[model samples]
Target: MSSISAHGLGGADDLPISGSLAIVGGTAALAISFVVLLLAWRQPRFGRAGHELAVPPPIARVLDGSWFRAGLRVMGIAFLAFMLWPALLGRNDLANPLLGVTYAWLWVGLVPLSLLFGPALRAMSPVRTLAELLDKGTGRSGGEGVVPYPAALGYWPAAIGLLTFVWLELISPSSTDVGVVRLWFAFYLAAMLLGWAVFGTTWIGRADPFEVYSTLVGRLSLWSRSASGRLVLVSPLRNLSRLRPEPGLVAVVAVLLGSTAYDSWSSSATWIRYVQSNEVDVTRLGTALMVVIILVVGTTFAVASMTTAVDTRRSARKELPRRLAHSLVPIIVGYMIAHYLTFLVEYGQQTLIQMSDPVGSGANLFGTADMEVNYWLSQNPTVLASIKVLAIVVGHVLGVMAAHDRAISLLPRRHHVVGQLALLAAMVGYTFMGLYLLFGS
Candidate 1:
């Protein structure tokens, strides 16, 4: 099988702004935001601030109706079948829709979907639907299994699952091969099903990577559930602050941020030349480097979160990282948009076209076989670069605010401003590195 080409609009030379300017601007934005937040925003104002607006009864009724939910579940299953036709029997070349669907639509497209809608995958997971059906057939409760889920497990399983997916996506030799992609999903489905049988629907929320990812990103969305289980619109910051700190939350965010960074780095000329010059196996080396990058990201954030002076009696230093992990969601979403915007726009269209002929029979079943992918984003490199920079800066600012609120709430009154200095520095470093990778790569 031919290697899949890296996706991007253009090289660093093609960017309108100089790399130095972008990095400096991004760093300045982060520093300024930190200072403004430190001085102007002294009190903790999220999580329990009650900024939510109840949805109208008519809209809420439709949204929470059983029929609507069932339709979504059916749609999810039908879409799964549509993609499986190509993965299981279509041509083994790039023409296959499987590769594009997996990489472009499902992976990259999920971010925006989650941001617009709340935990889209959790609402329409085919695996969860199937589990529920099986449980009903067995005369058992929908989310109940043979045993209760252990609280100690937390999000560790989801973190490991996410790491495995990134490894397959970024380092596997046959990542785009039809058979390999099919096999990977097969194992994923089997594991999810088996886990559901053992631990019930709770397993899906805690172990399914895509669901966990969507849930994390969905915190930024306006849609949220109220205390009475009704859907309501709330401030994104408040919704984000409601994320409960759990074990391995830091690791999950680390894998997301680190893998994206490695994706940018691996596409750079430096990494490509290094791989070509050495006699080492590219897969093994890439895998090791990816793991190291993830570890470094997690370690840096963990150390930074714990570096501040805190009253040990009030807040445990070791738990600070997980508590602050919600801030990284915005950063991850920002980098994802920067890295995958063109890819999603271009390849996503291409995938739609290919889906019209899933079996390679030259059938335009969906009348999209002849559609051409528009390269508008790629054609305008400067505009694309500007959007990327803006996204990074805005995300950095939001993250700064989130961190500041959490830090102040966790620390003593006197240490509020001082306790955030280390975290602020770490966030600045992240922004600088993100800009560097964006422009340099």
Candidate 2:
């Protein structure tokens, strides 16, 4: 199998913006936004659960209808079938649709899909659909399995799953090999099904890497459900504030941010030269570096979060990181868009074209084989760079606002502003680093 670039795009030199200018401007935007938030946003404005505008009845009914949900499941099943065709029978080369579908469409395309529509993957997960079907076939309620899901496992399995996936996509030398990709999916399907059989549908929520990632990003979307199970529209920030602090939450966010950052860093000329010159195994070194980057991100955020003086009677200092972890979702989404925009837009179309002839037999089953990918985004480097910087800056600004609101709600009034200093600094640091990677890499 031929290798494919994980991010199908040109290098930083192709970008029209000056690296130093973008970095400094992005950093200044974050700092200024933080100061503005500190002054203008004094009160705790979010974290009000059930605060949302009710959707129109017709729209709500359509969204909540059984038929609508079943249609989504059907689409999910069809999508899975389409993907499997390439994985199971297609060429073991980059021409296979499976490679682009797995890396670009599903991985990067998920961000925008979830952002526009809430938790699209969860609604469309073939594994969950199959598990549900199995439960029904056995006269089970789909909630209770052989054993209850352990609350302490909260997102830990998903964290590990996500880390493993990124390692394969970003570090593994054979990531594009059709055999390897097929095995990876086989293992994922087996593990998810087993987990569901043992712990019920809850396993999919807490353990499925793609589902968990999508759900987290979905929290930043305007779509949400109310306490009464009605579909409602809510401010993304307020919706994010409702995210419950759970075990392994910090680790999940860390893996996401760190993996994306590492993706950018690994693509740089500096890293490439180092890898070429060293006699060390590239896979081993890449894995180690990815892990270290993840650790550093988690550790720094945890430390920054707990540096504030907290009211011991109300909130435990140790739990602050997890409680505040929701704020990072915006940043993660922003970085994902900036990092994967070109790849998703360009390669996603290519994947669609490839899907038309999954087995390379010249069959136009999907009628897209004759279509060509539009490289508008890549062709306009200035527009692309502007979007990247804007996404990163806007995400950081929203994150700052979210963090401030959480801080005011949690910290003593006397120490509110002071309490957020370290966290703000850390956020600024993250923004700077992210921009540098975008520009430098």
Quote each prediction's TM-score: 0.97, 0.96
* Candidate 1 structure, TM-score to reference: 0.97
172-200: candidate 2 lDDT, tens digit per residue: 98898999989998999999999988999
Local distance difference test values of all predictions, in order:
0.87, 0.87
Off by over 4 Å in 1: 1-4, 313-315
lDDT of 1 by residue, 307-362 (tens): 77475643578888999999999999999998888888888888889889998999
Error in Å for residue 362 of model 1: 0.3
lDDT of 1 at 143: 80
Highest TM-score against the true fold, candidate: 1
Instruction: Name the 10 consecutive residues with the lowest summed lDDT in model 2.
Output: 1-10
